[model samples]
Target: MTRPQLTYRSWATALAALVTAAATALIGPAAPAQAAAVTFTNPLAEQRADPHVYRHTDGYYYLTATVPEYDRIVLRRATTLQGLATATERVIWRRHGSGEMGAHIWAPEIHFIDGRWYVYFAAGRTEDIWAIRPYVLESSAANPLDGPWVERGQLQPARSSFSLDATTFVHNGVRYLAWAEYAGSNSNIYLARAVNPWTYTGTPALIATPTYAWETRGYRVNEGPAVLIRNGRVFMTYSASATDASYAVGLLTAAAGSDLLNPASWSKRATPVLASDGRTGQWGPGHNSFTVAEDGSDVIVYHSRNYERYLGNGYDPLSDPNRRTRIQRVYWNADGTPNFGVPVPDGLTPVRLRSHDLPDRYLRHWEFRARLEPNVTNLADSQFRIVAGLSNASAISLESTNYPGYYLRHRNHQVWVERSDGSALFRQDATFTRRAGLADATKVSLESVNFPGQYVRHRDGLLYLEAVPDAAGRASATFALD
Candidate 1:
């Protein structure tokens, strides 16, 4: 007999009912079911730049980006984040043949506001392709993809000159619009209070500009503003420099309840929060937006090219078609600031293993040697893919992110990441059974499959497979996966 495949909605409903029934029988009231974890490979979509992902309250995720053609606005939707990889894209609107909205359509961002859908984008005229300005479209349809969109004309935030990349956010019952426009020769980020989705009421304030050396490389630019509010603070991230390998993300912050229109309320970080990393092979990671995962963890969505050099005929950045959309988890620091780690290499999403006993230390490989270290400079070296074991499907193996074919294995009671030799002994030596932490039941411990009494533990800042029969040994073996 064959069984029907279960959809995510049906499976989640069944799981919630089972948890509720069990809780009511044992305790007084039913408890809420926990959400399943989400993971996806790098380069979520190809030939997509300035990516924006918005999670709606109707149980779906909507995505839009700057397509290489720069002639139409497209949108896609999926129930799961990874499902957006192969989701069918629909073009909602196209550029005009001539006149105002006739050429160079770019950086379209979709937003749901006040029970309606709005799309803000930039375009140039037919006669002059470089005379770019921001524009808007409105739709009352419940689904944005199936829209009879009405053009609202150009958005004049101020005396606009070479303006683009418009993004909007609401705070304290008032909406605000932010975008990048030229003040003389320097492109700077500006903000203003919005009277409606497409119009602003007050003079735009200059929030950020290209001043530092990193922001002024190639060309002085500060564009693509995205906002995230959390922990009594508002974080505004914008891209800087030219749209090449020098492009990076800088941050501006202010108190959640403070006056957002005042330029003095915002503080700029001296260095970039996210940029190119040679170790991960991701170049020019910028123009980022934020969304929440299935498990309620914060996720950052951005675009980056795998290679540093332009693969097109000329040096024009617009000619490159490899700026693919990518997503990664956003980690928070102890002081409540966000830590956007380096762009992870292509593969299954990696996780960081934090030592339970020493909270600051994490499992990492240095020069192919396994050790527990703090403040690791190369974040890719500390990331690993916990996959099914090579020997047994029931066990697990830790695969290095940077070194694709390498895994953590124990030889003569010492743990090191080595290339698999594909032998039965090597498989068993690499595989481990995950068990409840012996020191803290809430955490996890890795027990050696071949050596029943031994576990992967840290001693003298190095990793080793040893017997964990004592309390100190158990503490050293426990870890918290992030």
Candidate 2:
């Protein structure tokens, strides 16, 4: 007997009732079904949108998105999928002011190319951050952390009034660039070949358009185009409808060996591969990208607004709607097509894959509090190594020993003990767990690495503070109720 086919729209409502009934229909399961599924919407990071995730060859998954912070690009990488929230982050690069790069940058993508790394992003000039043109940044380092990112300058733009979400793909030894252009005669998902980064000799070909009823929800607009090639097929996934309730994802496909430029080559999938539903409790699940788990399981990463609708007056809960990041596992059908699972709710601990092992080598696994040795210090700009306020020459270096748990600090908010262990204490789901209160640490017993900053869990919220030891030469901490 053959299993029946299901459309993406009905798939979630169906799966949640059957395959995921334990996680969906029943909560705080009487039987606590196994804990694996995509991450529930992160309440802490929910105020964001346009989340992009990529797995680097270095055994780390790097994720970034539009955030309230405009000073620098925030990024984090972790060995495990769940550690992303508390992972170490570095402002790899930043724009000085509000000109071409001075204001409102969106949808930055970091791609590894030709033994080096390059980041492609959309930013508008200071006058209008939304004039939004695609730009590229290059870093020659083996890893992006040891920064010194070199601005490669604006990549070849679409020459239209607005274009963004630039992504590069190599096919048949030829490199191609795909993007969304709204300033042209018409707005659609377009592709062009670049013998190099800045030149495109042929005219752009339109692969997909917003004609389907689902695709034309609020506006006949489609943007944020990303392409994935699998099994001799080119799959172009693009965001359709407006950025609000109308937001959804549409798929375009073409024969692997067909002339990509041929207008008829690419066919719309007829329906959205993903969409939003108030019924499932996850609102606006669109603008997505894909990643592979440590053992190569397909993980879908996307941005979403929580049960919010309408951008109206007075403190809109969805006001900060770049959308927070969410992840879910996806499997291909028997024919090698994509199958996106339903969105997991907030606060639910995801089930770990049966094959995952505890990576405890660094003792980084448990989240802890920390304490810095009393010495000269310059906490800012210098990271963990601090210079004495009285003397610049004398600096103290310390590791982030705090286990990823809760840390109590003096009211001044500076200098306190944190976890020294490498592991994080709280679970990764975005739900703020208020189940058990934190157990205060002994006045002098601190276990985390000290100094620069320590990550502590509070009601499930991760925060950082200055480390201060008691005058009695003792460090203090709080044990996680986690």
Candidate 3:
């Protein structure tokens, strides 16, 4: 015990321990790993309606939408989704002078089919502008922007009556086309199998109609069908009501392997998946297309008017040029269905906080009380902006996205999103110092600035400021800013 033998292994172990301790002492505790912030400005592009963002395998995002002029099919490509905002738009194909494809060029969705590029769009004649029909344009060029788009004529469904907003997808070795067509006096979504990009092989089946009260607002309408296949299910989102502020998004779902041409295969939701959020000043948020983000996360690309009123080109909502293109991340429910959430405000996008220990749960506010919940139906309740502290500039605060002026403040040790009464106590209660996660340094922990040793932790599904003195308590305090 007085004199230990200097073995090579023992000496190396002692030396390694001394080096680690010295390094730790020199730098204090290891700095926490900072997560890369993923954000994009709202209104991705101005005056772009029925926006479709397609991420190609060639590492480019191709964007095509309804131009305000309704005169041409324009295409823009960028490497990043955010870059699409400033990306140069090229009019790949223009309307015909007077015949078919002459007027009302709308909802141009770009898709790469087989080996050629295809643009499925709706157009009308100059003499009869209301005679809108879905059409297809093909290109042999590698880049659709630099295209010699050959008009493939109309993509004739089985019952093509004033058809528009056509979208195509292939599943189980079969390609199917989904579009909104006028059925009876109302516009309904129809589905059919496609032999080629321009032709349907079988009879088109009516999948969704404007029957619910939300679907029948200004008009008995259901149009703008967009297809997204995920989680063993085929999701079809279509726009309802008129093109005014009453326009919203409804969803129809079918089993992936089921007979898509059969009307019985699809089930429609009673309510819309996405609608206008007056709190965020977004109106008529409809005509959406889905795409994957750079990080391989699902993103919804849609058009919305920031203002509720239409003041451009008479009373027609379509005449208003302010229905700008926007995009946001799509969250998923426990059942694998998508939660589009509310149309977020026009600024930096908000983020969700996922519980570290309970991965399925998120920090959400219900009736103004902060708690952890899974599969939150109200998507806005789960979203928040991590901003500078209301009281201390050096700290941080969680601001509710839906309630602009409210923040997550600890009142009597319980967290709630309360309107700031402009009191010093309110600000102090809302402020929290961002610390390295007590359980996992890579994650984050919010410590109460007012109550130094207490941390914002989850207990019994509710959030509270409590002392994280144990491993379980530390785990509850940690959160992933997703």
Best TM-score goes to which candidate?
3
Better of 2 and 3 by TM-score: 3
lDDT of 3 by residue, 220-272 (tens): 99998888889999988989987888889999998988888888998999988
lDDT (Cα, 0-100) at 427 in candidate 2:
14
Model 2 has an lDDT value of: 0.53
TM-score of each: 0.84, 0.61, 0.87
Q: What TM-score would you give candidate 1 relative to the actual structure? A: 0.84
lDDT by residue (410-468, candidate 1, tens digit) is 99999999989989999999999877777876667888999998999999999999998
Point out the higher-scoring one by lDDT: 2 or 3.
Answer: 3
Q: Rank the candidates by TM-score, best first.
A: 3, 1, 2
Error of 2 at 357 (Å): 27
Worst 10 residues of 3 by lDDT: 21-30
RMSD of 2: 19.7
Residue 213, candidate 1: Cα error in Å is 1.6
Which regions of candidate 2 are displaced past 4 Å?
1-45, 69-71, 184-186, 197-199, 311-322, 348-482
What lDDT tens digits, residue by residue, belong to model 2 across residues 86-202? 566677878757577776567777777787777777777777766767777888888777766887667664455677777777877888887777743345777888756544658
Ranking by lDDT: 3, 1, 2
Task: Give the clash count for model 2.
Answer: 64
RMSD of each: 7.5, 19.7, 13.7
Q: Against the hidden true structure, what lDDT does model 3 obtain?
A: 0.84
